[model samples]
Target chain A: MEGNIYKKLLEELELGNKAVMITVMDDKECGEKNCNRKILYTEDNIANSCISDLNKVVYEKAKQSLETGNLEFVQVNETESYLIEPYFPEPRLIVFGGGHIAKPLVEFGARAGFLVTVIDDRPSFANTARFPGAEKVICESFDKCFDLINLNRSTFVVIVTRGHRHDMECLREVLKHDTAYVGMIGSKRRVKGAMEQLVNEGYSKKKLDKVNAPIGIEIGAVTPDEIAFSIIAQVIKYRRLADGKEEKKILSKVNWPEIDRDVLMELCEEDSLPKAIITIISTKGSVPRKAGAKMLVWSNGKVSGSIGGGCSEGEVIVKSRYLLRDREYEVHRVDMTAEVAEEEGMVCGGIMDVFLEPFWN
Target chain B: MEGNIYKKLLEELELGNKAVMITVMDDKECGEKNCNRKILYTEDNIANSCISDLNKVVYEKAKQSLETGNLEFVQVNETESYLIEPYFPEPRLIVFGGGHIAKPLVEFGARAGFLVTVIDDRPSFANTARFPGAEKVICESFDKCFDLINLNRSTFVVIVTRGHRHDMECLREVLKHDTAYVGMIGSKRRVKGAMEQLVNEGYSKKKLDKVNAPIGIEIGAVTPDEIAFSIIAQVIKYRRLADGKEEKKILSKVNWPEIDRDVLMELCEEDSLPKAIITIISTKGSVPRKAGAKMLVWSNGKVSGSIGGGCSEGEVIVKSRYLLRDREYEVHRVDMTAEVAEEEGMVCGGIMDVFLEPFWN
Candidate 1:
């Protein structure tokens, strides 16, 4: 909260350490007494209070979430519910070619919560402004970018360059990597040509089979936006539906982000800031954000991230002050199903299960 | 519209006729005088006013939308704007199993504007209450239900039955039909067993290749809802993409939906109730719905569908009444860029271009 919990989380993510953030979601009856009672569990350590009964309850669920690699909501008790949220630094889209289609693909990817990195030979094609929301924009040739980036189980390589040769080149490099998905945008004829040549060059039929050439779901999309939608849909399909068949990474213990972990590292380095990480693990009905949404609460009333900003969040903020004091990892529920929600000007009318866990490195 | 305009449209759709409905999307500046200028064009015929100068302009754009199979915003005249919207009886999700995963899949499908239909052997498994928003719930075996339904270019067939045998049975049957997608849920081992048996039994590799066995995207989904997320994502992928390559049907010239198509058809039939079909063909900035969102403006001050119901829509309704009276087909612009937009309680701070074409078929 004081420095950067996000950066610290990213650091933990780098170490390939699976993170299970447990939160208490009981907004109504629990009051502010048990507001900030949350816990964090890693493979080697537990943060906040992971020794309580809820820890035992959440541990198994967290392990399951880790195994499945999906976010879920669980009932901890009658009035209290816990969200067993697993953070997997998976589903990264690396788009080759900052073309028209890349615009929407990057935008959609970011919105769908994927870290999208775009590469292009031209500066005009690959710029921060064009892909404002994208994580990274590399203005370089496909060959250069290909050599620079890492291709692993989490990587989804998209070949949508301006020309066919570039696409073929990107495809060639991607097929050899530990990439989870490799989709190249091309006509049937063009893809056929590439495949024929690659096959002749001794690329295995199985390797060639991995590529989703003519990338996209094929809604007969014509425009860039429409085409982008198709491609993203296909990516999501591959990301979620695969049967352990794609490039999965060999994790290195204690992995961390090389850059931009400054804030979180700063927070971890500084012990004075007594903060709690509040994650919206599970939601029922209508809510602003889906599961896995997080917010950091500081004892002095500072916050980071957002679990939807409204009177509801304001209430959570107030509770964070008490929870930080109590150090109780309580499941707090937020019922925005009434006129109170309407009066609070909440867009979604649903219940939210929040877990406010005190932070510990 | 007289004597089932909805029926006529349905008839056209049945005949495999693609229709494009064009509208103007400016909600701020263009008042109701330019509201009712909408035109509907099919593969062979034109509705509303096709002979006008604007007809030529919209004709090309509409044709483009049809070819692209997507909704888009276009510039009609230098000053005028139009939205070339294609009416695709799209998002039809057909679930072969009424199992655990199918529950959330159906629910999500319905929410995502899909006409969902669930098929199961057990009566309890397939029921209206289980899938309230679904168009149909068939309480019969896969064979019985498969024989009853029409598998077309738009049908997204999902197989998530109880056991491996049921999954294989559904997959085998689905492979023969005209379906946009066919996904079956199973463990890797089970899927392998089915594949091996089907292959040994002389099922062509080409035919079996279409199935998305071990259905849904691979998000490590453990729970039913999480698993459902992956499946729905795959279905949506197939729905939006395919580029005439994936089981695009050889249309019967005139095809029709056996269920639904009530709204547009109803509008067409009520000659006494003249109306304008307003579709948000494209969008910019932050709006509630994107392109392809629609609303029906009736002469008697009634409306159907929604193009983001708020002050913005309220303004469109008022303008629609005027356009209906004037019989004008004007491409008007709506600018919600000013503080007036925020002051008027508009959630999105952007401009919309609305086409108000008089409905005279």
Candidate 2:
């Protein structure tokens, strides 16, 4: 039954659909035998849910969780709570220039888990050699690029062409589309001149104001790489924090934890039996990875993915090895406080409540 | 004589000496045929100089330029001006712990032109495979790493070890030396606890106050790559703008413009002759590169370095080709304003006064 639920999740995720996977952490008050039961919530319906009676309450919380894109533990009743993990497709970052700044921008954007696309009129600059991390590199003119890529609410656009005319052209075309982010790189005077030109071209002041001109946060970035860093930082802020009606799609994890895919697929295939799953259900302060981050520990001490790699993870893996031997399910608290560091050598800087479930069937 | 001067400059730079290269922009008011004369200022004396008559004034201005680390046009008289460009050795970035965050931090620090070194206790994590950008990677305990590397006023230390104890240990050792910047990655509570422990061990609060605890700028960086970007941005701010006595070494150009080295070496070897040297002497508004950025355009249209690449540079190259045939030295202005972009194809958004000189000897 757990394998079937995970298989449904993998299929939904593969289809580029948003999903909320709810796991009952404690079911002391629930009448149904729903403790450790997994329920998958899609946009329209629920699947593989054992707790049909609690679907109304669970649906409300899942909807809110999807809206906020937060992985958290929500109280259901007197003593029961559920871990809600929201998953969304990777955001698309379309850079409209393959210049100096665009190179690092592509690298950083891809590293931050944005599916990056580089579009430039020059074939020399817009090639796979230049942007190895970019998912697509289109050597086409600025005006012609609009027809090539899909622009939607989850798409981010950055204009960093060599000339102001090219910048304006890209801006004009990008402004017509619905995008999660739009940033153009230029000097303050250049930004003003370009904005004025757009305003003269009948672009509304309110619409043009949404463009992140002189793109990037004010970290006093002077170099091309620093500018790229600033731009991607701003992009991440919008991806994670922006909650506007127009930009409601939020992604909690930049790069999806590999273990979530690899181990879950292994569970679906009935191979790699006796694997212990460790998911961070809740985190206090300054943890490495956030809640919903998962890792799979095998019987032979091999592991996949990370929950803030270091001594704390080592301690958890040690306990998970023991859990795989005797326990079917357990809620373990990993403490990374100074007191713990002094006593048992746990080195992280926060506290995390993790759900450990062993699958041996 | 010009080749000899360039050779001397290269020698000084190779030896990692701070130098101020002064170029006379105009000699209309100055005597001694000082127009286009080159002067090199070291700490104690001047070398390869033809403007001995104006040494006192030039020396005074050169001293100020070295201290401020600014490339600017200094007026010597009513009509004559000099371009003061300062050069310093690469700053050293010593990263303790070759962990996940350390990977991107090393990449960013190295990309920002810092000589990076990564140290870790675990040999598996401390290797070239993990940190290819790092100049050196050492597999040694944090307590013993202080003896392996040199730490001075130009050194920036970043502590990102796996554990709080390691963070505290690295901090204690790092504080013993004088460094330009010191940043430690940890939670606010962990930092507070570590600082308190250091204070208990007789370290001054003022000294501890200087450390960039919870490292990186407040851009709300969540991922490791974003965190690395924020930290590198702060590092660049210190390297380019910090004006403290302890952090006096300022570097304007992150990566030494490749054209500066490759063409200067060509000049040193007398291999690239009949080359037109374009040096940005002054800038008005927002320019791609700052003053003192150079580009060498040859008679064959081959080039080295850049003065802000694109259509503006292309225009300069065309002008430089004309200059190589019929001109000795000319002061040309490349304007990237909207008015100029509308009239001509000059696409940048700023103004730069470039001194073009043909080196044909």
Candidate 3:
């Protein structure tokens, strides 16, 4: 029976299937007149022994088996013992660009243990000579290449094509799959435009939301290497999170209940007074408010702080609840000039970009 | 003078030199009349801040400067404080293999932000195609390539060559340089043969000792990916150790100096000892003693424990001092049947291995 079990486990492991093994030892066999010893093993050869005294013995055996890449079972009788192993498929990085940044990104991604594949419509850019470390280089349009590759949760798609339109084209295809990560490199304006286009094309809001537009953590990165650092950092963050490991830095700040409630209450109180509180969490281009700046709102809906504010606040307040609900905290550029910012009747002269996070109790 | 200093600092950073940034602030800058602030920023952009009442303001500015990758110096006499930016070069990984394992290792190394270079004798194996992720791939004999690469304290070298001979040849080259890590992959016999050859070659025992033969933590690795896992684990361990980070493993029994001494004394006192304690810290090949195993040496000097006693124990004991000095310990093997073992002792049959560590105090 032990031999049969061992053979079965070996088969599964060879086939790359995940499985666990259990062994039970009868009391008599355990040197305990009436007690039984039990052990469990995984296909990975991780073993757990129920008998504390037999732990060292079983652990050594398990380790030895693991070292030899073998799966086996030994009967201790009555007490159960077994091994468990989980098969993890290799991870792959599907890059949709072969530009300057893509060069280092691919090299780094490959070196980091991801089976990297670089794709470009231009044959010159997507050649083996150009991407020597890339596991595979495809000189085909993103649309056509998507069909040739198999993507899954372990697949990471980086859409860093030459332009926003190309980036969007790549993102549209990537979003259709269950990719572990989908990041597109673009300016804030370009990202917004691409997102709007995707949303208009009837892509599910949920899928659109999953895309990391203007990819990479906000590090004010300018150079290719610096940008690569930001992208890799974000990837590492996601990988850690997926593995249930603690991330070195908090990717997104938690929206404390009390803070959310307080901010909401303040906004509500000012509703009757015609004032607004403007909080800025981020900024881009020529924006007045820096990230994390806040302004108080007053009666008659006159705002003290800016979202970039002139005409941007009234609509902002309407959408603020959604941002609060979704926890989509980010910087917004609000036009304060009445002509540009005043869609309704109220116009603030100064432009302020506000990052309003809902304060809830 | 201040401008000159700032310019010099900027130049160093731009040239990718390593440096730390320090910032000092006065009371008013931190929003408190009497409060002061000081901050330190490392190359990785990890910041340590000291602030009083004006913590929020100072933190914001410090973070901004760090994000912008700017290093500077500023002074505010009365009302406000200034910020400083510093630049530091990233670390580099010097790999010695150009094999299948090197593929992922190089890829992962790049992704992890290491300046990676692959060195292999086979031009086909070391070319851009095989190691695209490698910033530079040197196609030269392993021994010759060492002359071209500069190995500093920060450089990490991983040896996963095609065979043991190549590994040994590469290791010898790296052993002469100041490196953060030197990991070699091989089986027990291969490792022993390589080491023996090195010892016979007149290489200083101390320098050769730094190599992590059978490199990687013993995690029961079998597959190439798993082997990669082990190698990476060792690399990470070395990196962390070099960075002064503490490993959290339970202290080894051998590491306990008092206990080791007690065991030695007890063995010495035994008029008719039944068992001798022989500790084998390392081993290679078809030897009776395995690394980390403890054996009992009989009173007749007839050993029951093996330390691959052949010729490895003397070195093991000398090296064990590292753990012993720190009051940290581990077990090792001593084989008494080999020529060296026979020359040194009164043996019992196959091999006489003993644990020479001190017993529990």
Candidate 4:
């Protein structure tokens, strides 16, 4: 049953649809109410859920995760614990010119988890050989690219055409799209001229305001690669969704591909036998990895993920097997500051408290 | 003479001294007064120069470059063309706590060209084994770190300690240093409380205003790595000296180490051979490398710097040798958009205009 639910989740993800998965972790006191159950939530509001009252919490958490695109640990009514993970579509980076800056931009964009697309009027400029990382290479006029690709809120567009003529044409098309970020690279005069023309043509000043003209976080980036770095930095800045000031956003853990795939698959399996899962709950001073890094240990000593693979993990692994024998949920303190840490051939010099919990069907 | 200049320059850099180098690239009409010349500019005002008028321009450029550490191309009196390279001491990054965020910050700081140091009271938290990239790792009390290391205007300090008490203590120490940037990580309330305490202790509101509290650019970065990215991004934004809206800075090419060292070394060589050097002056559309990239071509087919090593370079290399035969200074353009670019097993899909300059000592 969990497999079918996960299959749907993966399918929705592949289709570029948004979703949230809720997995129950603890049900020690909630007898026979589908303890340790799984639920799936989507934008359609039609979801696979269990245990009333907990479903309301899942719905609220699911909605919140959609905004942040984060994974969360939710305490469902104090007795039920659920881990809610959001699934956003692969981020799209649409480049409106296959220019010099676009070269490194595409490379950086791809490396930063964007499905990059390069659009140019000349076939020579937009091709696979130059942009191997680009998901699509559209060699068409400036206006044609808009009609070709789907530009939605998830799409990040960078306009860096060769001339003002091409830049103006692309600006027209970009304004029409429902996009997340729109950055145009040009001199102040060039960008202003393009924007003024668009405004004169009846486009709202508010619409033009959306564009990050003279694009990027000004890093004194002069070369194409430097400019590329600045542009990507700005994109990440926006994607990270920074509030103006003094707003300490509660950050979600890293969107680990390994965890999304491997852990999800493992959890979906119909393994009635219990398995110990270790999560770094707290940390201090020079830890190799951060909190949110997880490691799953089996009774047989096999493992998945890493809590900074060192003597600390070796100790945790031994303790995890012991945990499996006792079947007691415990918090294991790993202190890697002693001389033994150096002797173990590790560089970590911090203390971490890991919560070891076993999951059973 | 050039070697002594560079050795002095490097030594001054190690000592955190600021200086600038002005190199005369071309002077076709300036009589027999050395076509390729080098000049040094420092606060001592000692300079070995040919054109006194050009010396004024060098001084002005040097002063501006000092404010923003950047390499500039200066044209003096429309006749004396020079490259003014600014040399400041390696920017120092001093981390007050060797915590999770410090790990990635150290790695990123090293990659972004900063001499880093990690300081903490716990020997386990602050050690060489954890921070291989750090120039110094001080395992002492937070207050003791300041007395251990020299904190000058070129230093950037980040405080991310285990406790608010330690963070405040580090902040108090940091405020005493003449620093470039100061950031402290904590909740807004924590930072406010620290600042209030400092204000009560007679620190001016203006002085406390400089601290980037709750550190990092508002990227809702939660994980240590993500938070590190935001902090570094903010550091760069400040370092690059963004002057806010409409003042789009004219960025120079990337401070390429190879170009800086090789070109400087090559110019310093006493060889009187009329060597033809190729410098990428301008580029457009999908070129492998950016403008300001160089390729020093000798009389033979040997080359030093790379402007994307492919068939495009092969063509440039061939053209470079041809220019050497005639010993003529010319701007030879290489258009890689043609079909030949593909046939040459090349990936470049842009045009590059290279300045082929012949240097005669």
Candidate 5:
């Protein structure tokens, strides 16, 4: 039943639809069997409900969270609390060149959690060897490659092609897609020329003006790596800082690798090994991992994923093993408060509330 | 003879000594054989001299450059010009704990060209699997592990152990090393307590003030990765921004991966292959690679390293093939000046003076 909820949420994300995943945070008045229950709600309907009773209060909270794109821990009453998180499809980054700059750009882009795609007319430049971090590398002509890439509203386009002709071709096609960002790398003179040409070709000046010409923040970058760093920094600033004001919503919560798919898949498997799922429901101060980080602790002490990966994580694993044997849910508080931390062998001076739920298939 | 010069230079760098590598930039009055001829000059003596006639003028220039620690392209005369580059051992980043933050710290440190070493008492925490980017991972007690790591005056140390006890132990040992930078991860209260303890134990307040307590820059960082980024950014600022003023000289120049060891080792090998070495002696504006970027192109169209690696590099490769057969040197001018770049299929709006010389080894 839990697997079905996650499966439905993943499917909703895959379809470029918005969703709200509500996970019960506390056992409280609920029975041990109802502990850590979850519900997936989309715009159309309740995609999957792991909880037996989908209360009106929980449904209202999910709906409010979905509208505001907020992550909220809502306390309905003395007995119930839910962690409601709005989910959207991951943002996309499309590079129109796989040259020296593109190599580092793809690395920084992927590291920043954008699903990166590299496109170049030359196969040698547009190969996995050059851009190993890129999700897709398409060797296609510059003007005709738009059909190959998923140019959605949430996509960020960077044109760093070999010549002006290719840059113009990419810019023309990209303008029609209403991408979140369109940055073209070139000198001031080259950018001016490209803009003038596009304007003369009947493209609106206002649209052309929106492009991040000479792409990248002014960090006085000299090398390709530094330039790539500057560009990615600007991309992040745009995605995060322009939160509600921008038309393109900042989709996908959390950094890449924070959402451990392998652990989730293990949880989703049928009748798999007996394990305990540890989720950091809340955190305060300087913790290694934030709230929502999950880890899978098996019966034999083997583990997948991480909730900090230090003495704190080791403590969670120790607690999880006992919880797995008991086959119940427990909200364990991990105290790394500096004064007591040394005695407890914990480091990061923070406190975490972890929800440890025993699982079998 | 040229290979001997590079071999001796590498040896000096490996030994943590300072030296200067001077390469003749132009082939004017000097014969073709003298073009790109280099010399390795250490404090003791000239280690290797590829140029048969090392004039008094060049030696004086190298000595002056060594004193100022400057990278200079000096025009000795209308007939002779040389690019003088000082070589020092790579900066070392010693992370005291191979915990969650250390995972990203090693990566950022390595990327910033710091040779990183991670140490932890736990065998599970201190391993290659946890830190693939680190140069060394020593699994030993915090207090007893100093002998294993080379904590020289140029080393940057970060204390982030499993507890305050380990953090203090590491700090005590690290304080004796005269490291370039020392940072400790903790909350304000913990850092204050540790500092007070160290002061009571007889460490001077003047000395203790140097530590970057509460670690990282104030960027409102929360996650381990963000904190790691913040810490590494501070390290880089300490390195690149504080050049010349500090006692610990900013020694090794250029970013990591910019100096391709494979190409350099190949260049130093005895009659290994017939190839041409292309070095970007100077660049202006937004080019991919900076001055000193070297690439070796073989007769079989195989290439090692890169001088930008785009249309500009492709052009150089074609030029290198011609120069290889001719067995001569050419100071080729690559103009990617924006107006002319599009016509030539180049993108980066910069001009580069590349010294392409044929080699048989």
Candidate 6:
């Protein structure tokens, strides 16, 4: 009976089905000469056997299976034991380019228990030595590599090549596949150029929209490792989205009035209160916030949102007021490294480019 | 003057101080004839000034300086902006062992901007080639390495050695240092054995109390990488604790009534109503929750917490009742890879181990 139940569970799991099992045992049967035992398996429908207090046993077994993703057997007295096998599948990481960033990417990905694979046209770049953790390293062109690997919905694709052209070639091929995530590393201008080239090549704008160009949420990443983090973070975000998990938003859930046309016009007016607008254009490394995450500070102690909290925010606040007083529209770059942000207890080693502009009446 | 300010900020930070700078700029001095120009540096005990209205200018300058960690300033503003350079020290990750896990540890630490270093006797494991991003990797015995590296009041140490003896060796070395955190991975038996050995070696109870043995917050991590994550998480927790940040507790903070002696005795009675206890022992790969996170199920469709939500939880719920009916304690393992976790919408590729036991009356 246990063997049959295990076989059934394995079959359902392999077929991508869910199930729950319940066992009802008689306590008196344990000490009695001839006692009957009953076991029930509930796949899509409910299955039961002749047992005292059947409803209670069935309800519990069903609920237990549902709550813990486990299978078990329950006796009438709730004291016997049985086994249930759960179905789980392996994870895979599909990297598009095999470059310097990809080198660490493969290693980290493999160490993270991702079935890693590397693909590149250049055999020198894509090889076993370059990516030891990569299960398969294919020395095929970008166009052919897609066919070689099964790019399913479970696959995670990262495009880190020599330059924009190769990145675009890989992106085009990956976009055709049913991949869960697709990330390409490049500058905003470069990404824009790549998009235009793809559009010119007759790829649909809808298909292009699926790609995460300038890949990774903008953290103003400069180093290869930092860039890799941004890409990985984006991939994780995509996974959460695919799984329907809500990503934590920096902004509070408060009901802020939308910016009106009048407010915009007033802000643009020449004769308005001189306001220092400090906008974070980009961020890299261990920054408190990502590229688009912002903090607005007024000449007064009033503040909104944050680039990073603690000392970083306080320092930015002081600078904004100075910019306002001096009437200077200057750009400042802040590097948050161990040596710099340490006193503030910030370990995010990131560099942020902030543009401070004066808008006044 | 710049050197003096730098020296002052460093001194203040060394004493674990916090200060805010206010800059008040003098606009009239720059454009007016025979106008007095000045700059001011103010602290709690001292107020030094070179000119009037220097507060605004210097404050702005200091704020920008603080952002970039560039303490020096160029005279871009005619008003002479005051730059505030707040001294902030970065957090450090002091890894006690250099093994397979340490390779990823150094990579993650460097990318996360922690001043990472590996201490191991094996030269191959602690070489620069293995840990390129690590600020330092000391290939020395545990005792010698502890003396060489400065374990300050904010250092986070993680012990991941090949065996219990090495873990004990490192633990002994660290106990004397004024480190913020120390985490070691092993089974309860191994941890108890190590602690016994340490006690026998004359280590004080107070010092042993500081170590988080059988660590990683009780998460049932089986694989090396999973164990690495659990250890890293604990280190991160301690890092936050050092910064006075609250660590997020996994279980919901619930209010429970104090039980009287009579109530406790009554609860333990044999004829009392039976209860069901469900615990998640271990999880693998991309499961929603890590191991050791659990939930309890009652007969009335009521539930608390979760193992992994969705169809997986639904299955667990079903099996729970069966265990209650059978009056049996059973262990169930579920693998929810590729298949959706019921309607909870989690696509985690992993296996989960759950134990169902009858709650004694």
Query: Model 4 off-target regions past 4 Å?
Result: A1-8, A21-41, A44-62, A69-86, A90-179, A195-208, A223-225, A242-259, A262-361, B1-15, B20-99, B110-151, B158-176, B196-206, B242-361
lDDT by residue for model 5 (B1-361), tens: 5346778877776654557778765554545343456767875575354435666677776765554445566676676777776655577899998888898889877876788999998888898998999999999988789778877545788888877778888888888766667999999898999899999999989778888899965444445765675676566655543332254444443222234567778777876567888878788877877776789999889998988766778999999999888777677888777533452234448898887877664
Better of 1 and 6 by lDDT: 1
Q: What TM-score does each of the candidates earn?
A: 0.45, 0.64, 0.32, 0.58, 0.56, 0.39
By descending TM-score, how would the candidates be arranged?
Answer: 2, 4, 5, 1, 6, 3
lDDT of 6 by residue, A202-292 (tens): 9898777777777865444434655565555455445433321122322211111112222233333444355655545566675655433
Q: Candidate 3: what lDDT?
A: 0.53
Model 3: per-residue Cα lDDT over A194-299, one tens digit each: 7888889999877777677788655444447546655654554454334211223332321101112233334434233323334553344445444334455433
Put down candidate 1 lDDT per residue, B26-142, tens digits, no spaces: 333543344424556785575444556454766666766665566666664465666665665554678887877788778767754578888988777788998887899888867
Show model 5 residue runs off by greater than 4 Å: A1-70, A76-83, A104-112, A128-132, A151-158, A164-361, B1-71, B76-83, B129-132, B151-154, B168-361
Against the reference, the lDDT scores of all candidates come to: 0.67, 0.75, 0.53, 0.69, 0.72, 0.57
Residue range B47-160, candidate 2, lDDT tens digits: 444445564776677776765656666666665766677765457899998887999999988887788999998878899999999999999988787788988666888988
lDDT of 2 by residue, A226-245 (tens): 78877887787666555222
Lowest lDDT sum, 10 consecutive residues, model 2 chain A, at A339-348
Q: After superposition, how far is residue A243 of candidate 1 from its true place, in Å?
A: 14
Q: Report fnat, model 6.
A: 0.05
The chain B TM-scores of all candidates, as shown, are: 0.69, 0.65, 0.47, 0.66, 0.71, 0.47
CA RMSD per model (angstroms): 17.5, 9.1, 35.2, 9.0, 10.6, 36.4
Clashes of each: 84, 1, 122, 4, 0, 89
Candidate 3 TM-score to native: 0.32
| Candidate 4 per-residue lDDT over residues B161-230, each given as its tens digit | 7778888888887787657788999888878888888999998887788888999876556567667767
Q: Which pairs clash in model 4?
A: A99-B286, A222-B251, A242-B218, A251-B222
Whichever of 3 and 4 has more DockQ, that candidate is 4
Ranking by lDDT: 2, 5, 4, 1, 6, 3
Across residues A1-361, which tens digit of lDDT does each residue of candidate 1 receive? Answer: 2334445456567654556656555545544333523455665565443466564666676665654555666775676666665666546789998877898788767755578899998887889999997888998877778666767766888898877878888888888875667889889998898899999999999888878888876554544655676676666656555522544442212111112233344445546577776767568887776666767788888777778777788888888889788766655898777623352222448888887776653
